[model samples]
Target: MKQIRNFCVIAHIDHGKSTLSDRLLEYTKTIADREMQDQALDNMDLERERGITIKSHAIQMYYDRPSDGKQYTFNLIDTPGHVDFSYEVSRSIAACEGALLLVDASQGIQAQTISNLYLAIDHDLEIIPILNKVDMESAMIDEVSDQIIDLIGCEKEDIVLASGKTGLGVPDIMEAIVERIPAPEGDPGAPLQALIFDSVFNAYRGVIAYFRILNGTMRKGDLVRFVNTGKEYEADEIGVLKMTQHPKDKLEAGNVGYIITGIKESKEIKVGDTITTVERPCEKAIQGFEDVKPMVFAGIFPLDNDDFEDLRDSLEKLQLNDASLVFEPETSAALGFGFRCGFLGMLHLEIVQERLYREFDMDVITTVPNVSYNLMDKSGEEYTVRTPSELPEQHTIEMVEEPYITAQIITKPEFIGTIMTLCMEKRGTLTKQHYLTPERVELSFDLPLAEIVFDFYDRLKSVSRGYASFDYQPIEYRETDLVKLDIRLNGEPVDALSALVHRSKAEAFGRQICKKLKELLPRQQFVIAIQAAVGAKVIARETISALRKDVTAKCYGGDITRKRKLLEKQKAGKRRMRQFGKVEVPQKAFLDVLKL
Candidate 1:
């Protein structure tokens, strides 16, 4: 049997994990000359466009060395670097026995890098430190090495300095993996125990589950059963993928590959599930596998009710591949039927929306993201509501509770005062503060997660001139007096654009929504009334003046097509507006109101 080494690449955002993955693929000769692309492991267009690893991708590679006269198979898993999907990262780590911790040479170790490194340590994985971006002009190898040693508690000599973009030291890194990481140690004679790392859907082959062989050989036509779900199926065919380029044949014990069962749906397979033989099943599956809970949520409604089923199917397909995302049917009396989709964070929400447009080819109206709130009624019954419309009536609500987060802000010392003042203004309580470097400080605060879920990071970056880095984890829920503000245009309510805010900021929130609506929505031929009110009290009001001349005075039969096109454009523009019965609201009315 061939020896196998499994490892994952972990890093901070934009720290070259994907680029290093490409170099490793090149080193293993998995990709041909013509197939080379920058960060090939980031196969999704959305991931590449956003410059973040959204999904954890896996590949199998073969390495042969004449010096040692040995052939080895390496299973390389590239994990997402964002804090939002850290659960996915942890699962990726669980499927491997070692990790290549990539630290940017110029930027040193950031917050996410430290967080993922801790996860690796917690998993008991042997960490191979690699200093990436060494080809950069501002590369600081010594300082970064010192930081890695101090932060990760590793020796300086253990750090491998390399440039992934230039393919420098990649071969040596591969050799290090083959030499250092222990081969799969489970007994072939024991019951089959394969950890399903990931799975994908194929039209011809069905659900291809990628798993790491831990105990026994997984071959073609084996009767396998999922230990966690107690579902049994025959492994119809077994194959491995060269994720860098093409496909390969049957994979053996100790190698990472895919098994195509007759199971047609990808939902049948999940990450962290263990597959074993039915005759002699393993005692227990892997532990510590928890469902990924979404930290941010929003209402997603189709412009037309006919698109509801399409939207549901889109969300289902997306969830099949992405086990971390969650969604369900939600209905509002004013907005009709829609979905309340949960996301890892703001960036995750944006990526999902972008995918809906680009991949699913569906146009949707999304409400401002909100955190789920725990509402306590006068009878002491507790319930969770993701949208403001789902919340109980103000009179029925005895108390309002919302989630809090412990946020860490890394910024230049010059902006410490400004950041502190801003946090305080947002009702954040200072927890702790420490100097990270001579001119950098790490400030910790206990703030409402809802407050920071919006444009708080953007505002921080803007105020700090883009030199600030922030990280937050949900802390706990605290009671607060919060109210939902309903926005109206021309006397009708815009359900999709409703917002929840503290009673103190109700007027400001109303004014801000009206202002954004004016910018996003074009002026109409008739006067448009914009009004923001809480219950019966009008807090803000603005009017979009009607067009003086909406039609051409002079026209001919030949100009019919042009006139029809103009009217169509105008009608399309009106359709884009958030309409509440007789009222026509502009698109901007629903966007970035949280910025207020």
Candidate 2:
């Protein structure tokens, strides 16, 4: 049997992990000679556009060594760099025995890089430190290597300096993988045992589950049962990913690839679940795998009532590939029907929104994302609400609490004051601050998860002139005086725009919502008044001026259809606005409140 090495490529965001993977694919000729695409591993258009790997992808390649006169197969897994999908990355790590840790030569070690490195260490993977982006003029190979040594306790001599963009050190990196990273040691002769790391849906092939053969070989037509769920299926086909080129098939034991079974849904197979033959099923799967829990929740609605079913179907399809995503039918007395969608973090929420618009081709109305809250009622009954609209009345809520996070902000020393001030403004409690270098500092803060969720990172980057890196992990839930701000257009409430804010920032939030409404909603023939209130008190209000010339002066017979169409469009637009009795409030008013 051929020797196999399974490893993952890990790095901070934009640290050249994907680029490096592409070059390696080219060097190994995994793709056809004529096919040329940048970052071949980043298969999704949204992922390419955002310049981040949202999902983990696996590819297999064969390397021929002239020195040893032998061929070796390498199973390379590319993992996400964002902390929001850390759980997915961890699963990817579990399927591999080593990781190619990429660090940007110019940018040095980043927060997420350290975070992922620790995960690799926890997995007991041999680390191969690669200093990427060496083609850039600003690339500081020595400095970045030293920083890696300081942060990760790696020997400076162990760092490999190469440019992933130009295919500089890929061959050497591949050779190092075969030499340093141990080959899979499990016995293929044992009972069939494979761990499912990921699964995808195909229109013609059904569910394709990507698994790592741990202890045994799985052949085509083997009656395999999911060890965790007791569901059995016949493996119709086995295929390996040749990522260097476009993805090709036919994966084998001691390799990483996908298996096509008659199973129609990706939900039936889960990450960390084991697959084995019915005759000799494994009694236990790998431990330490936990179901991902979402931290942020938002309501997803459609502008047109006819689009509600479309939106729901789209979400269901998305959830099939993403187990971390959570959603259920939710309704507001005012907004009719929607879904309360839960995400792992702000980036997760943004990715979902982008996918809903780009992939599903659906225009979505998303409310302000909020963390789930636990509230004590006057009767001392405990209740958990994901949205403000579901919260108890202010008088009835005896105590309110929201989730908190431990945030680490890395920035230049010069902008420390601004970052601290902004954190303080968000009600952040200072925890500790340390200077990583004479010019660079790492600041820690205990802050409300809500405070950091909305554009706090953007604001920090702006204030630091894009020189700051920030990361946070959920710490705990803390008590706070939180209130649900209800937005009304004219007299009716816009449930889609309701927000939970600290009692201290209610008036400012109301004004911001009103301003956003005025900008988003077009001028109507009739006057529109947008108001934000808590209970019976009006906290902020803004007026959208009436359309000055809504009617056409000379309506020719041919222009009648055009005029009617215009009027119909205007009427349709008006329906989207919140109407309380007779008052009309534009839809923008609800959307703008969430914009930072």
Candidate 3:
């Protein structure tokens, strides 16, 4: 423990956390040149393509100080840089003694950047402020350094300027990490106690748990158990990360590594659970370890009913790796068997959908995502509703409360007008605004989570010309005039197309949804009327004209009565078709509703 330095790197999305981790691994010779890969810490293709860290990763490095001829062990962990994964970031911070706060030299501070820094501070971890990407010509190194000093409330003396792309100042940054960051302290003689911060599911080897040993020593072939679940298994292997798995006979206190217990079922292991020897169980589990709570939710249905069980199995395997994802079996009247899933935010929901489609090769249709709402009846009984279709009747409710979030946006000042307009359109109230730099400004707003879950981020990017970045944290549930809006095709309401919206914007939104559906739904043999309604009252409507087949083309010459009879016969057939015809909604229409 005396020679071990346990620390993590944190930053905003695209602020070079993964790149910095790569530089550190290269400098310390943890991974060889042939073995090195792009965005090495980011194992998922979604993360590499998007240039964001979605999960936290840990690895071991040995850096020898040439000045003193002494080598130190470094357990360098990289944390996710988005607000949606803050829960994972927080837990990763808890396992470390220090963190390197990387701020992009060109972009400077951001909403998520500040939020993650505060999380490190709350854990009382020693923070090394490092300005990254200094090699770029666009980098304003001096200005960003000053911002760091002001934020830390200290006269800057030891700020490290570095670039992950060019390997500039990397040596200095490594030195600061060793000299300033304290080594982790723990008792190796105590009973076994380790914390599972993250995990992954492997089909051949079962569940592999990534953990930091907090107390005692764990070795290969030991009988261990999960403290919370009371499940025991024989440790098949023990190892530290060497850019790849490197087996070790044992792991000491304050060291990070993986334990293979041969637990094939992914559901058996849980993140934040305590792991220890079955014969040497501790008196109690560690404090401050809690399950992640999901904020936004929606129903995900497999397009083919036969694949429902396959979807369930895939989700179960996914849950073994992602502790934040929660789901329960549900059935929709129109969509048949499906699951109602709970997620941390909209991005989380999207990632889940993408993975289900790409990883499992399953065709799925997702309903509009919704934030959980609190409702009360006349009898004072309170209940939580997650789907718009689950909203109670208006006559029975006493009050409705919707979840609100604090949005933080950083963008060029010229786009301020468009952003403000967009915010107000979503019923957002501006709380504060200030200039971070001469050209870039930060805007804070208190808005409902429902507003942001759909197209808020996309519109912000469009209006800001892709120069804006956003982050948000769920605040509180506030009373609002909210109503459940249902979409009707022809004459019948579709439960899968329902949504909850503010009463003030319900009618206009209904009109917009109706119009979009009219464009997306193909013209049929009979006229189709699209209507948006609240209860029995319709607020907006759109009509799709019936397809004409030229019924009278067969008659070259005929009596007027004969022509009229042919037209009458065609009208009766159309009337009968209208009564029995069903609208076949395509998958793209379900996706277009999210944009509206």
**Tens digits of per-residue lDDT for model 2, 273-348:** 8888888776667573677778888888877778899898787667766768889888876557888899988888
CA-lDDT, candidates in order: 0.79, 0.81, 0.87
lDDT value, candidate 3, whole model: 0.87
Clashing pairs in 3: none
Give residue 293's error in model 1 in angstroms.
1.2
How many clashes does each candidate structure show, in the order listed? 1, 8, 0
Give TM per candidate.
0.89, 0.90, 0.96
lDDT of 3 by residue, 508-569 (tens): 88999999999999899899999999988999999999998657877659688888888889
Give candidate 1's whole-model lDDT.
0.79
**Model 2 lowest lDDT segment of ten:** 243-252
- Badly placed stretches (over 4 Å) of model 2 are 244-253, 519-528, 544-581, 584-596
Could you tell which candidate, 2 or 3, scores higher by lDDT?
Answer: 3
